[model samples]
Each structure stands twice: as C-alpha cells, then as structure tokens.
Target: MEGLFQRELDPRWARTANNASHWATGVLAGAQYGLVAGSVARPRIGYGVPLGAGLWGTGYAVLPAAGLYRPITSYDRATLAKDLGAHLLYGLTTAAAFAALGPARCRARKAG
Candidate 1:
C-alpha cells in the first residue's frame, strides 16, 4: 500500500524504532538486574550482579553518543577500520554484559 511504502522508506521511522528498541532493551535489562538482586540472600552479591549488568546496559545505551558527533576528518581506509572496530567493540561489550549477568534468575531460590 502507498501508506506502508511511505512509512517503510522514512528515515525518521527507523530512528524512532531504534530509540524505542533501545528503551525496551534497557528496561528489560534493569528488570533482570532486579530479579538477580531479589534472588540472592546477600544483598551485596545481589546488588553487585545487577549493578554490573546495569552499568553495562547504561554504558551500552550511552555509547552511541560517541560515534554520533564524530569530527569531520579526511576519509581513508583507516577511518573505515576504526568505525568497524568501534562497532565490534560494542558487540563484544554487549556479549560480556549478558554473559556476566548469566541468567541470574535461573538458580533455585535459597530458603530463608
């Protein structure tokens, strides 16, 4: 349909989708952290695990800002490499975060 085509071709729609996805991901990550905090008897471990998760999530959410305001410089193969490297770093950081969180809710609850 014409309406569908307009929506699909719009850059604004993609940006909105990206922002919404980021917000949802952050909230879910925060909830996972809270669940981890709730499950552990020791408030320290409970807090630490979630804190780590949250720190990483927050870092992930803000990291896009770094690439957003890049300086206008000469373009070269090196520039391309650096951009790719940054993206790769982002992916690795995201993996490390989820791995570190590692299903904090999966273990059986400890009896009080």
Candidate 2:
C-alpha cells in the first residue's frame, strides 16, 4: 500500500492483513479439498500432493503475471526445490488431517 501511494502504513494493520490473507488462502484451499474429497468413497492422502504441486505451480505462473513475483526461471533450482518441498508438505498434511477427520456422514453415524 505504501508503494502505491506515499502514505505510511500502520504496522499492526499490516500484520493483521498479512495474517488474514494467509488464513483466507488456507481456508479456501481446505474447503476446495473438502468438496472434492467428499464426493469420493475413499479420500486418499496421496491426492494432496498434486493439489499442493498445482498450487505451487499456479503461483509461479500467476504471481509473475500479477507482478508479485519474478518469473520462475529467475530462481535457482535449489530455491525452487525448497519452496516446492514446503508446499508438498502442506499438501500431505492437509490430506492426512482430512482423512483423519473422515466424512461428516461417518462422524454423524458414529455419534448416533
């Protein structure tokens, strides 16, 4: 925001906005996965890696176009590998957690 205009930013608000954006992105991704996995008879943990890799690759393509990041080619292989590794972990953990929770119908049946 400061870059767009000459005005200074309030650090507290900046942090809050940053945190909110991070959370919103995570929530959106989780909801999307839930919708997808809910339709499956068995949701596999392995499915999440492709989701994560897709998100990472999409960011590389979209962020650069939006001017948030440089082209993927500008980064070294090691750096890209490390970033992709983190994203893969995110995907795996998301899938694992979703699987552990099971479906809402299962939980309802168990409760009854």
Candidate 3:
C-alpha cells in the first residue's frame, strides 16, 4: 500500500519521505478508527461500515478542500472507486477484530 501511494506522489519526493508519510497516515488513521470504535457503548463489527465510510468521505471530500491532497474530482473513476472500497473494507475488518476481542476481555474479567 505504501508503494502504491508512493507511486502516486511526486517523483521528487524521496522514498524515505514517502514511507514516513505512509506510516504516519496509517498510525493516525488507526488511532482515529480506534477512537470511533471505542466511542460506542458496545462496539459491534457492523459499526465499521459507517466508520469507514465517514473516514473515506472525509479523506476524499475534505482533505482536498483543506489542501492536504488532490481533489477527488481529479482522480479517475477507477482510482476513486478503488479507494472507497479499500477504506470500507478496512473499517469493517478493524471493527470486527475489535468486536471479537471485546467479548473475550469482558468474559475474562467476569471469570476473574
């Protein structure tokens, strides 16, 4: 994924810089996703869909407007669709993993 993103960036940017940016984005995104998941009274795997969608929407729509990235309109349809699908999947899987872990922790605490 970092490689893919690097390819999209300006060629003048060093590989190290692109890698750093990719890592930072991933860390920040994970933190944000975790916060969204934790905010719910009972985090469910299904919640990830909306969470992911929200993030995707913000990234595509807001990021460009804020000068963080190129505008969504500038991307070809295929790229846009690919990004949207990827984000939704990311959200679903992340939420599902969190939901799965949550029950076990609760059960362990109760047993203890």
Give the candidate number with the greatest TM-score.
Answer: 2
Q: Which ten residues in a row have the lowest lDDT in candidate 2?
A: 1-10
Clashing pairs in 3: none
Report the number of the highest-lDDT candidate. Answer: 2
**Better model by lDDT: candidate 1 vs candidate 2:** 2
**Once model 1 is optimally superposed onto the true structure by TM-score, how far is the C-alpha of residue 31 displaced, in angstroms?**
0.9
Ranking of all candidate structures by their TM-score, best first: 2, 3, 1
Which parts of model 3 have CA positions greater than 4 angstroms off? 1-10, 14-22, 39-41
lDDT tens digits, residue span 36-109, model 1: 54564433423443454444445444533443222333447686566555544544444455445554534433
lDDT of 2 by residue, 47-94 (tens): 889978987898789756755457899999999999899878888888
- Residues 10-93, candidate 3: write the lDDT tens digits: 556757664676467656876787776666657798888886787788877765654546777789989988988987887888
In model 1, the clashing pairs are none
Clashes of 1: 0
Which is better, 1 or 3, measured by lDDT? Answer: 3
Output the better candidate (1/3) by TM-score.
Answer: 3
